[model samples]
Target chain A: MSLDKEKIKHVAKLARISVDEAKVDSLTKDLNSIFKFIEQLNELNTDKVEPLTSILNQSLRSRKDEISDGKIREKILKNSPKKNEEFFVVPKVVE
Target chain B: MSNITNQSLSEILKSIKSKKISSLELTQEYIKNIENAKKLNAFVTTTFDKALENAKKFDNKPNNEQLLSGIPLAVKDLFCTENVKTTAGSNILNNFVPSYESTVTKNLWNNGAFLLGKLNCDEFAMGSSNETSFFGNVINPIGDHLVPGGSSGGSSSALAADLTPATIGTDTGGSIRQPASFTGTVGLKPTYGLCSRWGIVAFASSLDQAGPMTKTVNDCSIMLEAMSGFDDKDSTSINKKKESYSKNLKDNIKGLKIGIPKEYRVDNMPKEIDELWEKGKKILKDLGAQLIDISLPHTKYALPTYYIVAPAEASSNLARYDGVRYGYRSQKGKDLIEMYENTRSEGFGDEVKRRILIGTYVLSSGYYDAYYLKAQKVRQLIKKDFDDSFTKVDAILTPSTPSSAFKIGEKTNDPVSMYLNDIFTVPVNLAGLPALSLPAGLDKQGYPLGLQLIGKALDEQKILNIGYAFEKNCGYKNEIKKWWS
Candidate 1:
C-alpha cells in the first residue's frame, strides 16, 4: 500500500496539483505512512455491512424545479480571479 | 467597566439588557482586547470598523429581546462572511471576499450578534493543530509556545483570550472540542445537520458541523440555540422544531444513566487525563446520575476511517478551486489544465495538498473499493456502536483529547501523531451525534484537560445539561493569566 514517487505523481496529476520534483520524495514518504495507517481498516470484516452514504435515514428532499432567483450575473462574477462582462475568463481552453 | 471583557455571554447580555453596558461600549472593550493581544496571532482579519459601526447601530436602536442582542463575536475564518475576507486560513482565498453570507453566520447576525473579526484556523479546517494555518500559528493564550488546538484554534484562542465574548467553530473531527479542551473553554458539536453548511468553504461535507465555543457550558447552550435551525438551502439540515436549549437546560441529571466507554482508554494515556476522567465520573455520580461501563467496540478504527472518508470527500469538494472562479491563480501556467495544477499546488498549503492527494488516491479507480468503500462500511460500524450504546445509557463520558495542548513544532513532521489528537472526539462526529467538551481540570503543567459528554443524535440538550451540572460541581476554573498582554 506504500506510494512510490511515480504513484505520487500520478495521484497528484489526478488531483490537478503539480508536485515539485524536490518534494516528491518526502511526499511519497508521508503518503506511505498515512496509507500504512489506513491499512488498519482492512482488519475489520464488513462483507455484509452497508456503506454509509448519509447519516440521516431519510431520502433527499426535492424542491420545485423552477427559476428561483436570477438577474445577479454581476454579483456572481464579482469574486472571479479573472472575469469579463458576464462570464469567468479562464486560460484558452480551445486553441 | 474595565473587567467587562471578562464576563460571559450571558452576563454581557444581562448588562446590555439592564442598560449597564451599551453594545457600543462592549464592542469597544473587545476591540481593545484584540488590539492589545495581537501577539497571540489569533485573528486573521479584524473587522473593528465594521464591528464598531454595527455596534453603534445596535446601540442607537437597542433590541434586548433578541438572543444575542448586539453581542460581537469573532468566528473562525472558515465561515464565509459576506463582503468580508473569508480565507479559511489558506493562501488560495487570501483575496477572496464572499459575495453571500453563509447560512450559519447569517443566522448569528440575525440573532443580533455582529462580526468582531474573522479568526484564524487550520487551512480549510484540515489540521488538528493551528500550525497548518497559512495565516500563521495561533499561540494558545495559556502559554507562550503552546499550539492552540485547531482547526477552530482561532475561535478557541479568541474566546479563551476574551477577544470575543463567545465564538463559533466548525468541527469536522475535533476542530471545536479539541481546541476547546486545550484552551479551557466550552465547545459543543451539535448533531450533524443541526446547523446548515451553506456557503461554508467545503472541507468534508458530511462531517463538517458548526457549533459554539464559549467560556461556559451555559453560553454554549445559548449560542447553539441561536446558531442551529432548518435551512432550505442545505438539504441535510434537520427540519425538526428548534428546542429551547437555554430555557430547558436543567443542571439536575438525577436518575439519568451515563455511559463510561471502556474502550476510550487508549494505551499510554496520560495519568492525569485518566484521573480527570475518574473525577468526572465521581462528580456525575455525586450528582445522582447512574454511571454504567459500556463498550463502543469499533472505537479504535474511527481515526483510520475518518482519514479515508474526510480526504476522499475533500478532494472532490476542493476540485471547485480550479483557478477559474475565485481564489489564487498561478502565473506560471500556459494552458487551462496547467493553470489548475499550478494554482492548486501554489495556492494550497502542504497539509491541505497532502489531504487532497490522499483523497484523490483513495477515490481513484483501482483503490476505491479497498479504501473509500471499506472506510464507509467501517463508518457504519462506528455509528452502530454508538447507537447500540445509547440504547443502554442516556449519554457517554470520555476524555476530550488524549493529552493537553502540545508545544508548537513538536508533531508537525509526523502527520499520524497529529491525527491522534482527535481520537476521543472523532467518534462523535462519525455517529452524527452531539458532544460537548467541558474544561474539567488541568494537567501537571497547568495545561487544561477536558471531559466530553457524548449524546444521541439531536440530543444536545441532554449533554449540555449534564455539562452544566458537571460545571457546577467540578470546581475547575481556568486560571489563564493574560500572559500575552
Candidate 2:
C-alpha cells in the first residue's frame, strides 16, 4: 500500500499535476500514510453488498432534448484565461 | 445602531417588516462591523456599496411577503455569485467570476437577501480547518489565534462575529457543522438532493450539500426554507413541494424516540465532549423526549470511507480546472500536457494536491476495486446502519466534533489528525441525511462545544424542532468578546 517517489510521480502525471522533485519524497510519505490508513477498509466483508453511487432511490429524471437557451457565447467565453472569437485557446495540441 | 448587528436574522426580519428599521440602515451597520473586524480575515471580498444600493431599493418598495426582505448575508466563497469573484478560497480561481449564479444563492436573492460579501473558506471546501484557504486562515472569534472550524470557517466566524446576521455554507464531510460547532453557531447540512448543486464549486458531487449557518436554530430553519427547492437544472434535485420548515416548526417532542448511538463514543474522547453529550441527553429527557441506546456498527469506518470516496470524486470533478477554461494558467509550460500539469501544480494548495493525488491513485487502473469500489460498498453499509437505527428512533444525537477549535498550525503537518476532526459529522453526509450542530456547552478553556442531531433524509423539520426545543432549555450562550475588533 505504500507509495514510492516514482509511484507518486506516476499518479501526479495521471492527475495532470506536476510534482517537484524536491517535494516528491515528502509527498510520497504523506500519500503512503494516507493509503495505509485507507487500507483499513479491507477489513470489511462486502461480497454481497451493492456499491452505492447515488443516495436517492429514484431514477434520473429526463427532459425533452431541445434547444433551451442560447446566443450568449460572449458570457461563456468571458472567464477563459486565453480565448479567441468563439473558443478557449490552449497550447497547441497537434503538431 | 451599534447593537443592531447583534440581532438574529429572525429578529431583524420582524424589525424590517414593522418598518422600525430600514434595510439601508441595517446594511450600513453591518458594513461598519465588517470594516472594523478585518483582522479576523473572515471576508475574501466585501460588497458594501452594492449591498447598500440593494437595501435602498428594498426600502423604496418594502415587501413584507418575502422571506429575507433585503437582509444582507455573507456566504462562503464556495458558492458562485453572478459577476462576483467566487474563489472557493483557492488561488486557481482567484480571478474567475461566474457568468451565472448558483441555484442556492439565486434562491436567497429572490427572497430578498443581498450579498454583503463572499466569505473565506477551506480551498474547494476541502479542509477541516480554515488553514488550507489560499486567501488565508480565518481566526475564530471565540478566542485570539484559535482556528475557525472550516470549509465554512468564514461563514461561522462572520456569523459569530456578528458581521453577517446569517450566512450559508456547504458541507461535504464536516465543512458546515464542524465549523458551526467550533464557533458556537448553528449549521445544518440538509438531505443531499434537497438543495440543488447547480453553481457550487464542485468538490465531491455526491456528498456536497448547501445549508445555513446562523446564530440560532430558528434562523437556521428560516434560511434553509429559503435556500432549498427542486431545480430542473440539477438532475439530482428532488422534485417535491417545498415544506414550510419555519412556519411548521413546533418544539413539542413529547414521547419522541431519540437515539444515542453507542459507536459515537470513540476512545480517548475528551472528558468535556462526553459530558456535553450526557448533558444533551439529560436535557432532551427533561423535555419529555425518550432517549434510547442504538448501534451504528459501521461508524468506525466512516472517516476512512470518506477519505477514499470524497477524494476520488474530487479528482474527477476538479479535472475540469485544466488551464484553458478560466482559472490560473502557468507560464512555464511548453506544450498542452505540460501546461495542464504546471497550471494545476502552481495553482492548487498542498492539501488539494494531496487529495487529487490520492484520488488519482485510487481510481487508477489497478487499484479501483481495492480502494474506490470497496469504499462505495462500505458507504452502503454505513448508510444501512443509519437506516436500521432510524426505524427504532426518530433521530440520533452525537457530538458535532471530537474536540473544540484547535489553535492555528496545530495539526497542519498531520493530515490524518486533521481528517479525524470530522469523525462524527462525516457519516451523515455519506448517508445523505440531514444533521444540525448547535452549541450545547463549552470546554474548560471557554471554547464552545456542539451537539448534533441526525435526521432521516428530507426530514429537516423533525431535527429543526428537536434543535429548537434543545436551544430553549440548554441555557448555553456564546460569550464571544469582540477581541479582534
DockQ of each: 0.89, 0.88
lDDT score at residue B412, model 1, on the 0-100 scale: 97
List, residue by residue over B1-485, the lDDT tens digit for candidate 1: 89998888999999999999999999999999999999999999999999999999999999988999989999999889989999999999999998899999999999999999999999999988899999899999999999889999999899989999999999999899999999999999999999999988989999999999999888998999999999999999989998899999899999999999999999999999999999999999999999999999999999999999999999999999987788899988889999999999999999999999999999999899999999999999999999999899999999999999999999999999999999999988888999999999999999999999999998899999999999999998887899878
Q: What lDDT does the true structure give each of the candidates?
A: 0.93, 0.94
- Tens-digit lDDT track for model 2 on B1-485? 56878988999999899988999999999999999899999999999989999999999998889999979999999989999999999999999999999999999999999999999999999998899999999999998779999889999999999999999999999899999999999999999999999999999999999999998989999999999999999999999999999999999989999999999999899999999999999999999999999999999999999999999999999999987889899988889999999999999999999999999888999999999999999999999999999999999999999999999999999899999999999999999999999999989999999999999999999999999999999998888788876
My TM-score estimates for the predictions, one after another, are 0.99, 0.99
Second chain TM-score per prediction? 0.99, 0.99
lDDT of 2 at B340: 95
